[model samples]
Target: MAVFGTNETKVMLPRNIADGMIKETRTLSTIAKLSAREPQRFGETEYITFNDFPKAEFVEEGAQKASTTGGFGSVKSKPHKAQVTMRFNEEVQWASEDYQLSILSQLGDAGQVALARALDLGAYHRINPLTGSVITGWDNYVTATTKSVEIATADADADLRAAVGLLLNQPTSWGVNGVAIDPKFAWSLSNLQTKNADGSPSGVQRYPNLGFGTDITSILGINAAQGNTVSGTPEAADTKVRAIVGDFQNGIRWGIQRELPVELIRFGDPDGQGDLKRNNQIALRLEVVYGWYVFADRFSKIVDAV
Candidate 1:
């Protein structure tokens, strides 16, 4: 007997498509490129954080060694699902093999981009890209850290330097090795100019290497990535977060689950639009789980004056 209902069931995406999506996500997401990552499963994954490191002490001969302890803590990375669904013409199903592959590739591209954006939005701003709302219960870097630098309209260089200074001056001495900056903030840096002896703008660019583009790889000798997600759209008109500077190797960690499911639905309205069957459209839904944790006092955010 032919099982027609089974044909509409969801299935795991091909390994090639899934791997390509992950590669594109890492390429597009600034945080993903800078932060430490690990393989995450469906459940919680825990990583240890050191509050203090025990030091070796010089002991006198015949003297008893005193007991020493180091402060250690753990942070659990809880799985958060991010999904993207798109509708396409049903005619794609009857297309040639090459044409079908092209359509699938395009769908994969959209899914990767959405996943990248969601990572930035959730990790940096705690915003959910799907609902355009703040995700409760999880504190993003902006809300979780107290260290911050306010940008002055007159001195963009000072703003960046101040942000780095905050990290270096911390009691634990955080390093400023990587920076994820917003597009608007990058523009500010590129337009910065030195002043002449008479207080006039010296035509020379203060940071000549810092340009306003998506391909920015470095800023002032520090690794950098530019994306609008750095300063995500908040629900309210609050202080705009411009950049995050920190020890990317140790300050934050994130990961995505390997299994990615892509489903094809030819009936019903999955997106609240008209029915797909009635409209002669089919929907492709891609889902993947992601997790992240930001260490306390390890990062400093730069924001415009409130």
Candidate 2:
């Protein structure tokens, strides 16, 4: 059973962190041997870099050709089978949470499903049988909010909460407040670190950073100017109830390079940049985050391990 009882969960997204979340957390020892104990752990091992290009030299006329033919900027990272490390974080107690955690669970499950069906090479070895901490893909989402013409930043929080409540109240199979992660996803995940473009890590897992919008205002909520009542509506009251779709503004996608168990997955990008890590066999972490922009252009893609 998981260290958090059978039903315990890692705090995916901390509730109090409005500015940001931790990049690392306490490491569990059953699956990994920690070196420095990163607050956010990693599952990835060695990664390839353009820096691996063969050493070059100025050939004197015609000496034995230097190690490589240098290309001014043609170096690229190639796929390789790197070591896979799995990890988990939890309290000895039980189910506590972060909204980010919920998001991670959703994306990680989706990644697991997509990877399982497509990983025909069979790279995962399941080092820890008790809990398959090995994972393949994941998500992260942040709301880039802007004040509406009539709405102030002060009101953003309440509006966001109201929108979330509305979504929660929508009809579904389970009770409105207790929506479960989609069951069709494959694979599994623990948490991972996020980082700045300079690579200073942050406490965000990489998975389920989804975008769900069919029109404008996906990231910003209702915006209206003061007005008079025409249809029983008050001034400054915009009838457009479309809540911002946080995922639609920025999102990502990932695919494995070679065969290996994915160990860690981080998600946030500090310095407010637009890129993320993906395991095309780069980076030290096994399951580095990556990017893509496919807004349901076709059928949804995922891996479900049930």
Candidate achieving the largest TM-score: 1
| lDDT computed for candidate 1 | 0.78
TM-score of each: 0.89, 0.16
Query: Relative to the unseen true structure, what is the C-alpha lDDT of residue 65 in candidate 2, on a scale of 0 to 100?
Result: 70
The 10 consecutive residues of candidate 1 with the worst lDDT sum are 1-10
Instruction: Judge candidate 2 against the unseen true structure and give its global Cα lDDT, from 0 to 1.
Output: 0.25
Model 2 clashes, total count: 44
lDDT of 2 by residue, 60-136 (tens): 87678745743333212222232322332322123353432453444444344333222211111111121333223
- Model 1 lDDT per residue over 1-306, tens place: 211123766756667888898898998888888875677776788888777876777899999998776777888877778888889998877777677667778888889999988888887778878677777878645446788888766777688888888888756785778989888788888887889999999999887776544467888788988888877854323338888888887777778765787788888999998999899998888888887777757888888876
Model 2 CA deviation exceeding 4 Å by range? 1-13, 16-53, 59-125, 128-306
Query: Model 1 segments beyond 4 Å from truth?
Result: 1-8, 60-63, 140-143, 212-214, 233-239
